[model samples]
Target: MTNLKLHIDYPHDIPIDAFQWTPETTLEPFHTHTSLEIGCCISGSGVFYFEQKCYTVRPGDIFIVNQTELHIAQSDEVDPSTFIFINFDPSILLLEDEKLLLPYSYQSEKFQNHIPAETSLACQLQPRIMTIHEELSQQDVGYLSRARSILIDISVLLLRNYIGSISSEQWRRMNHSYRELRQMLEFVHRHFGSNIQLADVAQTVGWSQARTSRLFREYTGKSLRDYLAQLRLSEVKKRLVTTDDLIANICFDCGFQSMASFYRAFHANTGTSPKEYREMNGLSEDFEKLGDANEKSK
Candidate 1:
C-alpha cells in the first residue's frame, strides 16, 4: 500500500527561515534558495536526500544541507514523522569586518565538507539548536541579532572541530563526485519547468544520456523524469499557496500542458485537489496573518 502525503506551507516570516514539518509518508519535491539549512529529527526514522547521497536519519540525529541542494524527506517505516528545519542565507551573519568571525564561507570549497555525515562538530553543535529555535520563536526586537550571533558561533565550532582535519585525498574523492552531481542538479533546477529531455540534461552535464540517467538514479533512487515532474508540481503547489493565480495560469507556469494533466498530477502527488489542498492548509488565513505580523514586526 502507498500512503504518500505532501504539504506545502510557509510557516515563518523572519528572513532567518524556520518551519516545522510532520509527514506520515514523504515530503513533496522541493528546493530551497541559496541558504544553509540544518534539520533535526525529533521522532521516527527516514532518509534525507542531498548531495547525491541518501543519509539515514533517526531521532536525535541532525543533518546539514548546503545551499542549492535538491532534497526531500521520506519516512522509511510506517510510523509518524516530525522534524524542525532552520534555514538562513549566509549573508545574514557575514558583516564586512566580521566576515572572518563567521564560519566557512559557502563561496569557498570549505562549506562542502559538512554534508551527509555528522562531523564531531555537528555533534557538539546539536544541543544549541534548541536555544536558537526558542529565540527565533520569541521574535523580539533583538532576536534576529541574537540568532545571527548563535549561527556564526555554531559555524565556527563546526569548522574548527570537524572541517579543519580532512586529508587532501579524502577531500578530492568527495569533491569529484559532488561537483559533477551538483552540476547536473543545477541543470535540472533550471530546466525542470520546460520540455526537458534526459539527453538534454545529459548534454548539459557532459555525460552520455544513458550514463547520466544511471548515475542520477543511483544517486537519488528515482528516475530523472519523475524528479523533474515532482519539482514542477512543487512549484505549482507553492504558487497556489502564496498567490491568487488562476489554476490554468498556474498550470502553464508550472509546465503542465493542460488542466486535466495538472489536476491528475496534483491530486496524485498531494492526495487532494489543488484547491482543496490550499484550503485545508490554511493558505488564505495564514497568509493574511503572516502579512499583518510582518508589518507589525517591521
Candidate 2:
C-alpha cells in the first residue's frame, strides 16, 4: 500500500535523470519524491506550484524542489512551454557541506523551492542548466562525468550566493516540528492506500489525533483525508496513462473500494472522466487495451 509517488528508487549507476517536456504534456498531480529536482524553463511559459505558493515560469527560470516538498507545473495552453528537468541524488556528489545547499539541506530557513528568471541567481544558473541539458540530450562521450561536474558547480553557486542561514534559536524551534511532520508524511506515504486513519499517524508520530489533524492542516493546508484521497487519485491517474489495466482493476489497485468512488474523485480532481483524460493525453493505446481487459473481465 506504499504510495509510489513519495518513495523513489534512484538508479544504481548514475543516480541522475533528465527529462524534456513539451506543450502536449499533461500536468502531474501534486506529489513528492526523494530525489532533489532542478529544472529550467527552456521555452514558452508555465506556472509552478510549490507547496502553497505559485510562481510564473518562463525561459531561463531555474527552480529547485526539495525531496519533501509537494509540487506540480502546468503549461499555458495558448503559448505552451518546454522544460528540462534534472533530478539527482545528493549522495552522488562529493561535497564539503551538502546542507548549505537548499535542496540538500533538510532544516534551514534559507531553503528555496524556486528562483524566478528575473533574479540574478537564475541568470547565473541558466547557462549552466542549458549546458547540462545539451550534454544530456546529445550524450557526448563524457556526458555523465560532465553532467556531474556541472551539478557540483550549481551546488556551489547556490550555497555561496543564494541560500540563507538561520540562527540556532530558530533552528531549534523549527527542527522538532519539521522532523515530526516529515515522519508523519513518511507514514502516510507508506500506508495511504491501506486503512490508515488519523489515529494511526498520530500514534506513529506520538501526537494526539486531534493535534495531528491540526498540525497536518497547518503544514500542508489540506485535511488528512483529503490528502490521502489526493494520493490515491494521483496513482489512478498514473495508471490510466501508462497501464493497460481495466478501469475497475485500477480503481481497486489504487485503493479505491468502488468504481463510483474512483470516478467521482478522478473527475473532481481533473475536471474530466478518466477515460476522457486518457484519450486527451494521447494514451489511447492503453485506453483501448483497458477496454479489452474490461471485456475479458466481464
The digit string of per-residue lDDT tens for model 2 on 135-216 reads: 8778776787888888888888876664345556655555555666777877787786676888999998799999999877
The residue pairs in collision within model 1 are: none
Candidate 1 stretches greater than 4 Å from native: 1-123, 128-165, 286-298
Q: Which parts of model 2 have CA positions greater than 4 angstroms off?
A: 1-12, 23-27, 94-96, 100-112, 168-298
Candidate 2, after superposition: displacement of residue 256 in Å? 42
Q: How far out, in Å, is residue 99 in model 2?
A: 3.5
Candidate 1's displacement at residue 283, Å, is: 3.9
lDDT score for candidate 1 against the true structure:
0.63
Residue-level lDDT of model 1, residues 74-135, one tens digit each, is 78667665777777644333321222222333332243433332555556666667667877
Error of 2 at 32 (Å): 0.7
Each candidate structure's TM-score, on Cα atoms with residue i matched to residue i, is 0.49, 0.51
Best by TM-score: 2
Name the 10 consecutive residues with the lowest summed lDDT in model 2.
94-103
